[model samples]
Target: MRLGRVFSVIAVCFFVSACSWFGGDEKRLPDIPEQQLYDEAITALEQQEYETAVEKLQMLEARYPFGRYSEQAQLELIFAYHKNFEPEAARAAADRFIRLHPSHENIDYAYYLKGLTAFEQDQSMFQRFLPIDIDQRDPGAARSSFESFSTLINRYPDSSYAPDAQKRMLFLKNRLASYEVHVANYYMKRGAYIAAANRGRYVVENLKETPATPDALAVMYQAYELLGEQQLAQSARDVLLANYPNYPLKSYKVKNTSLLETATFGLFGSESEADDPPRPTTEDKQGLEKPENEAQKEQETKRPWYHKATFGIFE
Candidate 1:
C-alpha cells in the first residue's frame, strides 16, 4: 500500500509537469503585464545571463504566443541564443517567429535574424588546401539568408534596417557568384570542358541580369574554345558580344577593335569633307588677302591706296 501511494505521487508530479509545458498553469507566469515580462527578459539578456533570459522569454512566448509581447519575446530569445553563440538555437527561434507571424510588422527582422544565424554558422571542410570550396559551405542555408535579406529589402524599403539589409544582400550576391566561379574554374582546370561550360552557362543564363554574368560568359567562351567545339565557342562568343562587348576576350579584342573602327569612321561620316585641302586660287599665289570688312577697311585706310590695291589683287 505504501509503494502504491509513492507511485501515485510520481504520476501526479509528471502530470503537473506536462500540463505546465502546455500552459495549463497560468500562475507560473508573472503577475505584471506582458511588456514587463519582456523588459525583465531584456534585462537578463543585457546582463549576458542567456539561460535566464531564455527561460523568461520562453515563458512569455509560450504563455503569450499571440499576445502583445509575443514577437518581442521571440526576437529577444533569438538574440539571447545568438549572444550565447548557439546559432542553431537562434535560427530555430527565428524560424518559429517567421512561421507564426508571416504578416507581422517585424517579420523582416525575423528574416534578418534567420539569415544572420546561417551566415554565422557557415564553415567548410576544405579549409586547409583550398581556401574556397567549389561548393559553398552551406548553400541551402546561404540561399535562405539571401532570400531573407532580399525579402527584407523588397518589403521594407524605407525601414531603418533597409540600408544594412541592402549591403548584406550585395555581399550575399557576390558570394553566390563567387561560388559559381569557383566551380566553373575548378572544372576548367581539371580539363572537364563540358562541366565547365555547363557551370559557366548556368551563371550566364540564370544570373545574366547580374554584373557577374559577363565574366561567366567569358569563361564559358574560353572553355568552349579549348574543347575545340567550334559551334559552342561561336555561341558563347555571340553571348559575349551581345551582353559584354567591352570585355577583353581574344575573339572580342579584334571584333571590338573593328567595331570601334567602324563606329568611329562610319558615324563620324567620311573624312573627305574635313581632309580635303582648300582649292588653290590666286590667293595661293600670293599671301591670302583679308575680305574688306569694317575692321579691314579701317586697317587698309591706314595703308597707302596703291599698297591696298596690290594686296586686293588676290581678292
Candidate 2:
C-alpha cells in the first residue's frame, strides 16, 4: 500500500511539472525567426530596454548560434549593458565576443568596449577626488582600463579608435606616475630621504618614458644629496644634464656646512702669520714675534674696537 502511495505521489509531481512547462500559459520561447528576432532585439536596445534586449539577444544566440546576426547581436548586447551602466555585464559580453571571434571585423570595437566598460566601472568623483579616503589608490579598475586600451592600441595601431586609446593610455600613465611622485614627496617632507630617493629611483628606472621622468630625476637628486649619497646625486645630476642640458643643475643651491662652521668660528680670532714654523721674515725676530705675526698681532691688538668696548677687556 505504501509503495503504491509513493508511486502515485511521484506521478502527480511529474504531471504538474510537465503541465507547468507546456500548458500553464507560459509564453513558449519562439523559434529563431532570422531577421525578425534580430530586428526585435535591436528595437528593444534602441528603446533603452536593456533587460528585454538582453533576453531577446540571448535567445537569438541560443537558437541561431551560427546565424549571420549572432555576432552582431552579441556585440550590441554589450553596448546595451554599457549604456545601462551595467559594466560587469558589458565586460563579460565583450570578452565572450573577443574569445569567440578574435578576428571578427568588429573586433577592435569589441576591445574598445571592454576598455570602456573598465573605465565606467570606476568609482565616482567623491571616491576618486577626495583625500579623506583610500579610494584614490584603487588602481584595479583604472589599470584594467589602461591595459585593455593599450592592447587595442598595440593590436590595431591603425584602427579609428587608436588615437582615443592612446590619449587615455597617456592619461592613465601620467596618473600612475604622479601617484609615485606623491609618495616620494611625502617621504621627502618627512625627512625620510632614503625612502624618497628610492621611490624616485624606481620611477626613473621603470617609468623613464613617462612625463614624470624629469621631475623624478630632480627629486631623486635632492633626496640623494639630503641622504649624503653624493655618488647617486652626481649620477642623477648627470642624467638630468644628459636629458635636459639647459635645466641648470648648478642653480640648485646646497650648503657647505664645513665652510660655514669654519667661517663662523674664524671671525673670533685672526690668523697668525708666524705660526707657520718660523718662515724666514725680512725683519729679524730678536727673540720676539716675527713681523707678519706682529702685524697680525697688531691687527688683533686693535680688537676691532667693538669687542674691547663690549667685553671691557684688552688683549
lDDT of 1 by residue, 233-253 (tens): 889889788877788875422
* C-alpha lDDT score of every prediction, in listed order: 0.73, 0.78
Q: Give lDDT tens digits, candidate 2, residues 157-205.
A: 9999889888877777776677677888777777788888887888888
lDDT of candidate 2 at residue 304, scale 0 to 100: 55
TM-score of each: 0.58, 0.62
On a 0 to 100 scale, what is the lDDT of residue 21 in model 2? 79
RMSD of each: 21.8, 12.8
On TM-score, the leading prediction is 2
Which residue runs does candidate 2 get wrong by more than 4 Å? Answer: 1-34, 123-135, 186-198, 205-211, 222-228, 241-315
